[model samples]
Target: MTVAAISWSAANARRMERQFLLNPAKPGQAGPGEVVDAMLAAHAQVMSAAELSVGLRMDGATRLDVRDALWGEEPSLVKTYGPRGTIHFLPVSELPMWTGALSAVPGGPSPFKAGDRLTPSQTDEIVGAIGEALDGACLTIDELSDEVVARTGPWAGDLVLPAFQGMWPRWRSVMHVAGHRGVLCFAPNRGRKVTYTRPSAAGSEEPPLSAEVAAGRLVRRFLYAYGPATSPEFAKWAAAPARWAGEVFASLASAGEIEAVEMEGVPSSWVVAGDTEFPAEPVRGVRLLPYFDAYVIASHPRERLFPGRAYERALAGGQAGNFPVLLVDGIVAGVWHQRRSGRRITVTVEPLGSLNAGQERELEGQAERVGEVLEGWAELVVGPVAVGAHA
Candidate 1:
């Protein structure tokens, strides 16, 4: 059977516009819950970056709006450790699905085979202890660790490990582990210390969605947002074992939930069965996407999005989010950085090639939008379009 095809241009436009990156922010246009639900979750390692991520999509959204949606009373959003075990801002009501899907993911064995590390059983105990400790209240990691020790014996706190910041206690590692159980999520910051809380409207009972069920839904959700991908791509995105991702893909393909399509030069492309409608209008306008933007990460097959020399300059060590990028139409055309001085946000765009009058105009407008989101004036500085400087 000949699989249907989705062009690079079409796919880019549909996802950019649908993901709301091509539009202006309209404050309160969509409820806080709806904004995140559309993208599944926003990359939120840095709270400010996450705020900018949401602001670009909505109309005139202020930082406080993002905060209210998150760490607010009657919040419409929830903070949780999502795909790849990275912190993300998830829609509040979707905790069950996120938890169910993530919980099923095999974390694999501890990297260190032996030593002062958490045994499998001990790790699980920490997860359970976290849920119980934070059942209806917020607690700092240190505060919660004490309760975990009380619940699971001293083994829960004895395991100390090295991390990006420094040595991470067993209690700290399990924070995301507890997140997978759907009972625990991050609470608002209390002064300088981070805290954990139970998700609003979350039940203490067992997760309603099973691992198998959640895995299938996760596949569909990924394809719905970034489709025409292979099983391996899904695995990379979810941080799941390859064998498991293949099983999920097979199950979905058998159920007719997704179908295969032959992309131009690529093989084994599949999209949601009925989500093949291409954008009626081609994507226009320029966009200055921040580091770790969802659009940059969601797309599969780096070569298509970054193209030839564009990839090297935009990515560092083949990793995304190392540098902010310039997007003309739908492909990465250059790299840019911003510096804020008082009320002025000066954006320096270093393109890979010369731009026409129209692209320059659109880029300035895009820069202005960024300034608006930051509540500052925008100044555009177009430097020479150069690449391969390191080479």
Candidate 2:
């Protein structure tokens, strides 16, 4: 059947969830850490560095183990590629193609465009100086800036700081491009320090794919990983231009990679892999999805994924800043937070609507799991903590 025919019924959503959310089995695995690493590489979202660490913990993976398995051997590879402008733990085989696609897309607005002004040439020099300083050493952004000022004479003192003040936007663009070129990659951070490394010779010599091809490949990957999505969803999630997003979907359709699907009540057309199909029932459990989790942040038209009234509360502040939420039966039922007092770790669940006994128990269980991954010895407490209603 064509994509337009298959509706994203509750069954379809659950099937996608099982494939991408639940950890895969690895029989006769070598190390616990390695097995966890593979699971994360395949499923976890690494779009934001902080999100990567948090997602692992939520998925029953520990911080130390994640670092040991994914970051221990080749520190540089971790930082090089992934979705959004962040570093995801992608399969080594998919690294080259993914990075190439992301780099071809033009970056979003730079925060530096506001007050801190620098000509394009000056910005180039600033980046060049930072790169030179980080030639062989892994330094934090602060350290890199310090080194740039120390070596660049007068430009380093005041001009560099202001010029570089709002530079993350610009630097991120360069990072995207350089990441595609296999020049720099994401590594573990020591506090605010940004640990980076040069890409391997093999990664460096690889040629980038054309923009159209890269976009198509990326869309396909997203569909396979987070399928039954729409062009707008793909566009928002990948940060690709709308026109490019449409083209990618069209190209995928041409290649038989995606088929259109219709939501029962929604009017817009959705796309999923040609082979994509969901089960007949929904998984009965509550899952604590971390902030900016792929499942939550994969698209802008999130109303389909969440209840209508609860949207404003979950996304309390605004679209750009959404609080961490609890997903019950593929719908956002409430928001959750962790409070640590001395040795006790208290997980407070604030449901937007009244929850039944089963849902409450499920939330408690999920909260306990979160506690286990975060603090090994801390006491776990799960229940409602009164908080003001959110808009």
Candidate 3:
């Protein structure tokens, strides 16, 4: 079959629109849960950023609204470990799919040596213990560690896996795996401490799909949201083994579940079967994206997405999401920073080039919107941002 080609700008517009970043839904038109569903998952390691990532997409949403969706009666979202083994807010209804697909990822060699690591059987035992521990309850990590240690053996609590300033328990290593298997998820913070609970407690009742089936579905969804991408890019995004991702993409292509594409200046790419259309016009707008925002993290071909000065100023060593970005027409055009003092927030944006009067007004509006999502009054400052990643 002859491969179809797409210009990078059009592809960027399609991806941004699909993620609701190009033209976000209006106030009250979309909810936080809906935003999470559209983005697949909202990166949540930095909870505040994740809240903005979701809230910014839903024009009227506030951080509290996002909190409610995760912790309110009949919660609609689940906080768990997701792609790249990072914290994310995934839709509750899709927990089963997430578990199946994540658990199926082929893990690499342990970062720990033999003595510090849990044996395969020990790992399974610990995972089972975690599910049993968190059933019908939410426990702090220390409290859960006690329960996990008691239910299993002391070896489960052995402090060997090195962490910042100290070693973590053997069981801590499998926390992400347990999260993948639907046995664990985040609960509301207990004061200053984090807590964990089960997916069942979060209103997820469906059993997981088979690994093969779940993986196929996940791949299709990835293509839909971030497609016209190569297997290597998917592998990097998912943190899966390159060989495994290649095999999966090849299988999908052979099964007619995805089709090949020839992107300008790129060797090969694939999109969901029959998903070959692009937006009629390239995306045009000024927007503020929080750190680790899913759209910035998942989009491929960094050179095209970041472009020119953004490649150096916005990105940290070619890694997206380490710094909050100022985007112009779906491309990173500057870097931004935010500071909150009492009920007011100061949003400082440094665009690579001078904005016209119209763009300046739009930027002020965007800054105010960021403050609104954070539930604070915002003051915009157009100046130099002299800080490093995540500063």
Candidate 4:
């Protein structure tokens, strides 16, 4: 049997509307928690950026709304290290499943392989120490380090290595390790320092899903949220090993959860079977997305989103965080940056191509929505930004 191909336009439209980045059906009805659940997780290395990300998707959402979901009592959101071992805001309800699947991804090459440092047994010792150190109370990295030394011996602290953040100890990867062990997690900020806490380890009432089952669920979530994707795309997005992702996709295809579909000019893509409904209206208007927005990262064949000059200007070192993106018609058209002084916020937009009157009008609206999320008066200044310029 022949599988149906999904056009770029149809796939882009469906993804945009469903993710609430475009043509939101209900305004103000969905809160921060629901918005995040829809998108699986929000990139949160920069806390304010993730807040803006959530605010853009929900009707009348504010920084406080996202904050409440994150830090409030009976919290609906949880922050953790995920997807490249960077911070993300995830729904608290799905913590179990996310931990199960994300922990399965293999870590990067370690210097220990050359027997320089971090022997395999020592690595396990540090991971165990981190869980014991946190023991329910939130502790800063410094405090955790001391506790780890207490448990694993002082030599653990001596295992320092060069890091972007000054000199970091070898056990820094233990955060990813602890996360995989389903023990340690990020705690709400205590004063100026980041803290961590461990969850209760009482075994789940139901038997935990095997690694295969967990990986299957993660792959399904990726395609459901960002479908028409290739295994390589899914692997990159999930931070899973290529061979592992290939095997998961094979299993999923055999189970009929997804089907291979040819995208025009694009070699291979897969989408959830029977998910073919197109959007009522075509993708129109403009949007100023935050740095590392899921819309910017999850989409595949980025050449389509960042074509021509956009490929060079909007991306740096083949990464997206260099600047927030300007989206027009469900594709990246430019780059933008925002600066605030007191009550006034200034936005600088650098479009890759010219925009006509209607599109320019949409840009104005985009600025307004951006300001609403910021809770400040926002002004848009369009044109090329000078090299090494500030907004």
Q: Estimate each model's TM-score.
A: 0.91, 0.74, 0.98, 0.91
For 1-391, candidate 1 gives per-residue lDDT tens digits of: 4355667777777777667877753655676567777777888887766777787788777667778888766777888888888888888767767888998888876665377667678778788887788888889978888888899887666657777787766666667777777767888889999988877533234343888887888788888877777888888777889998888888888898988876666768778877778786778877887768777877867888888878888877676765678987788889887778999988888988888999988898888878887788889998843432211
Report the lDDT tens digits of candidate 3 across residue range 1-391. Answer: 6365788888888888878887677876667777788898999999989999988887677899899999999888999999999899999877878899999999998888978878889989999999999999999999999999999999899888889899888899999999999999999989999999999998897889999989988888888988789999989999999999999998888999999887875757989999999988988889999999999898989988988888999888889999999888788899999999998999999999978887788899999999998999999999999778973
| Rank order (by lDDT, best first) | 3, 1, 4, 2
Q: How close is candidate 1 to the true structure, as a TM-score?
A: 0.91
Regions more than 4 Å wrong, model 2: 1-4, 11-60, 74-77, 80-91, 108-136, 146-177, 190-192, 201-210, 265-273, 299-301, 317-321, 377-391
Q: What would the per-residue lDDT of candidate 2 be over residues 211-275, giving only the tens digit for each residue?
A: 77777777765665455567877777766677877877777777877777666644445445545
Cα error, candidate 1, residue 331 (Å): 0.7
Candidate 1, residue 200: lDDT: 50
Backbone clash numbers for all candidates listed? 6, 7, 0, 1
Q: What is the lDDT of residue 100 in candidate 2?
A: 70
Clash number for candidate 2:
7
lDDT of each: 0.77, 0.54, 0.89, 0.76
Off by over 4 Å in 3: 27-29
Candidate closest to the true structure, highest TM-score? 3
Which residue pairs of candidate 1 clash?
Answer: 25-58, 25-59, 25-60, 26-58, 26-59, 27-59
Task: Show where candidate 1 strays beyond 4 Å.
Answer: 24-29, 164-166, 201-208, 384-391
